[model samples]
Target chain A: MRQMMVGVVALSALMAFPAMAAEGKRVSVKGELIDTWCYFSGVMGRPDAVVGSAHHTCAMWCAAGGIPIGLLGEDGEVYMVLKLPGDDASNGGETFLTMTNDTVEAEGMVYERDGLTYLVVSEVTSNDGIPNRTHEDFGVVPGNVIPDAVVDKVLEEG
Target chain B: MRRLVTLLACAATPVVAQAPLPFDIGGSFSLVDQRGDTRTEDSFGGPSLLFFGYAQCQSICTVALPRMAEAVDLLAERGVEVQPVLVTVDPVRDTPASLRDHAPDIHPRLVALTGSEDALAGARKAFRVESEVIGEDIEGPLYAHGSFVYLLDAEGEVLTLLPPVLGADRMAEIAMGYLEAKP
Candidate 1:
């Protein structure tokens, strides 16, 4: 039944995909910044483990590597972050690189397109820092993203 | 079984209820191609799929370039000819000669591009894509760049941008939807 609906939508899209003005709404949301590629791809670990401090280092790599970031909203819907506050650019910048894994309260214009939600952050109202702290449980998600020398020294100390 | 049938019954991509994004995203760029021939945004005579990635990038470039190429093939099969283009972020490493050797492997018809830092910066800024040297891996200097695949017209107008995460089929479908909508 659901597949049938998708098929129907697909057919309708073919016929009437006329360009319309962009429609959006302004709202505030609280969520952790995440690497959308890893989060959606599930390449690193279980969704629960690939976030917070555990995923922080890898998130930095992914962010700098041109992967888009998203806000895993408290509502559980991942909002594709088109732009972050104070940044005129879209994909990667120091602002987003620094904010990776930090939970933030932001108000922005939200647009829904093609089964996805996009957020253009106007201002980040507050930041809660990296509070999720999955590193304690997940141990750096892939555990290899960090250099072996660093891990080896830490393990030696332990 | 029934679900697969339903998907095959309709268009190649899904969710056509889309509006043109309200961002200003296109501009003229003067870039050089693999053969060291100068090319600009208007170089492709027909519709094209453009990606911002480096030839040596092992990250999103690996994931996106092939998909963009496949999308080009898919569009060709549908009688919609679309060129696939890649503009390199690593101009120093992805020289014209290196891209000349590598571009064909990614796609027989791929137009791999490189340019002066100032010229490439203009292009990136026009498209609002950020390019920065993020780190160094064993491979050499790694860069962070924009991964969205842009659908462009002959005049370099951006029709739409597709996320790299989408499958080739979905990307093709979205391209078809926009192309077919044009007059």
Candidate 2:
């Protein structure tokens, strides 16, 4: 009787929190396709991570180099873009290469782990042309241009 | 046996559907502003839209920053004041002077920030933004980082993440929705 009671209590506890119950779902989302690593890492501190038509070559290289793809939804949700089984390798990187910087509608199965979301992309369609802003003239500057005072302060703190 | 199989399948199915799990996205930081003054998370007494990008960025930042400026302007027109902030990912080159030069082109009221490498790294980690130096031997070495704009409440708690796909007008509308809903 005691064992049965414990089992019932455990079952009730599991029923209370439902989020841990399933893998994910099949859904469609409309958004801009992005390279995950560069979008996440380079945008914060690096210029090369910027996403747009100007950076299409770099993005394509990254995608082909095995970096995962991502879709940034209009609602601010980020989905990790993936290729389904039997999908051509060219469909993800090669296709995205041509479609870089454009908004797209994608259908996929969405999953989440460790606070990050992933989408196994089954289909994709372009929604609009690329936005008209590009930074073609922005050139890299030398890294040693900081004033002596700031350098001193940083070294002192270090 | 059939009943047991059904029970097992039901047990394995996840209950919650749309919402992803809670994430660790925002935290406190101390950095220098475009004016070379030190500022903290509490410097802005109201809601702020924060994003990470470098002044030398030739791609997304160019578009994102201008749209951010427009969003700020739109919010102001609606009688909602929202601070727009740009935190540089390239600490080695994006000095206060650089920020000052670049920020005004985006918006007169935009605040640009940079700090020591350690401080910038700490802030990035707090926000879960990824950044790294690439192509050092190339003509124009650049840092790559995340491109999401984060909306934070007065107390510096993250409210939402904005992707680059949202236009200035749409961004303003969403931001207004959040501000209006604030108690």
Candidate 3:
């Protein structure tokens, strides 16, 4: 009876391992905007308290010494439609793109690849009062390129 | 009752608006550039464009540094000597080999540095600059930072911060302005 009971306990412990590993860790982050990479904010999160402003956050990625990236989602997951920086009028804002945003949010696993951090977002939602806007507001101006002269003439005539 | 309510509203209002953080200028700290070279405040011959950054920097560093280097080359072609420094904020990961492989192609005269975190912290404190590292979705975590190509006088006093994206001629002009100024 004693040996049988021990066997049951050992099997239960083995079953719990995968469950424990799946549970991701969450922690608070905050910091100053030191640099920005590829329209992505490289604001240094304070190790002590993970918090900072959006302006600071954006400023970090926009900084001269910062890295830029396209926000990566999970395999086969789709991100919002957006434009990229340096997109020409001919291309209509389609090149150099990613699912990047400004608002700080909670995500799943935070990992680094190719010397840049990739935040695996299980559920990415915005914080603070700012609603999640598209890359258009961030100066990306996604989709349907309207020529400057045509836009001006239409506005003037209208 | 209306006057009492108005008085309460006035009391609830803030006394003053928040001011921006004052960026401090001109103190000195010892640091190592990406080249594994130990540079003090006195390294540059003329006014130096002291830039604090790292090898892992993807966006601004890669783009801006090359632009700045191109501008510097343009200046050099015109017979001007300007020293540029690239200091790594992430010292632990930014090895000298990494800098040599990735950074030197930006410009001929550019200097790279990576040192102890304390040294970097000291330099940041001295410059009144700041930084923080955060978790990312693609990689692990990255340092979110600001861009400034600091125009420092020969004596290491900051004149002004150039914008992250500017033409080489304009950058050369800014550096020239500081070079013309008397310490």
lDDT of each candidate versus the true structure: 0.80, 0.62, 0.45
List RMSD in Å for every model shown.
7.0, 16.9, 20.9
What TM-scores do the predictions have? 0.85, 0.55, 0.49
Best lDDT among the predictions, by candidate number: 1
| Cα lDDT of model 2 by residue, B110-144, tens digit | 88989999999878877766665644534355654
Model 1 residue B11 lDDT score: 25
lDDT of 3 by residue, A1-158 (tens): 01112122222322433232122234222211112232221222321111122223343334312332223222211121111234321101212112223333433344221112323334445433223333223321211234568657976999
Weakest ten-residue segment in model 3 chain B by summed lDDT: B14-23
- For A62-142, candidate 1 gives per-residue lDDT tens digits of 887778888988877677888886776766677888999999999988865564567889899999999998999888878
Task: Name model 2 segments beyond 4 Å from true.
Answer: A1-158, B1-21, B136-140
Ranking of all predicted structures according to lDDT, beginning with the best and ending with the worst: 1, 2, 3
lDDT per residue (tens digit) for residues B66-147 in model 1 = 9999999999999999989999999999999999999999999999989999999988887788888877888789888888
What C-alpha lDDT, on a 0 to 100 scale, does residue B67 get in candidate 2? 80
Stretches of candidate 3 off by over 4 Å are: A1-140, A143-158, B1-23, B137-140
lDDT at position A3, candidate 1: 10
State how far residue B82 of model 2 sits from its true place (Å): 0.6
